[model samples]
Target: MSSPLSVILTQNKLTGENFNDWKRNLLIVLNFEKHSFVLAQPRPPTPAIDAPDRDFVALERWDNSNLSAMCYIRASMSNVLQKQHEEHQT
Candidate 1:
């Protein structure tokens, strides 16, 4: 269920002792995927029906980035960690 690009990011999965390296690698991959923005920004609130177009667009972008980051994070974790974090978004 993971993307092929996960291979590039998960060369060394997030073992407990490797937080620094794992985070660095994950950020590099996330940046390459153009999803690093989600790390710096909080999730935007959902737009109202009559909200400006830009609001919808921002929410869409946030969703894409959040999903991508979540998948990558899961793909790079040990099975135990992944299960514990199944529903985490940030």
Candidate 2:
């Protein structure tokens, strides 16, 4: 079973509405925890005509040196995603 903190850490979706706050908070939390991570917002291949209509893709990358930490984080994220999928299906 994964811990609640791990699930909360990985479950946030970075959207334009809260981009600045999300980035700041994520950096602070990950840094304080000594977890190396990269938060990137990639641009779509085809740009949207309207600025607000543009889709932003957020990618998170982290080091896998610590096996336990890696597994814990991955499992937590997987569990949350699975729950989200099931919820959408119902």
Best by lDDT: 1
**RMSD to truth, every model:** 2.0, 12.6
* Per-residue error (Å), model 1, residue 71: 0.4
lDDT (C-alpha) at residue 71 in model 2: 41
TM-score of 1: 0.85
Kindly report which residue stretches of model 1 are placed more than 4 angstroms away from their true locations once superposed.
Answer: 1-5
Q: Tens-digit lDDT track for model 1 on 1-90?
A: 255556766687987788898998888788878898998999899989999999999999999888888888888888888888888767
What clash pairs does model 1 have? none
Locate the minimum summed-lDDT window of 10 residues in model 1. 1-10
lDDT agreement of model 1 with the native:
0.84
lDDT of 1 at 81: 86
Error of 2 at 66 (Å): 9.8
For all predicted structures, in order, the TM-scores are: 0.85, 0.31
| Top candidate (TM-score) | 1
Across 32-70, the per-residue lDDT of candidate 2 in tens digits comes to 555433323222345355534323222112322133333
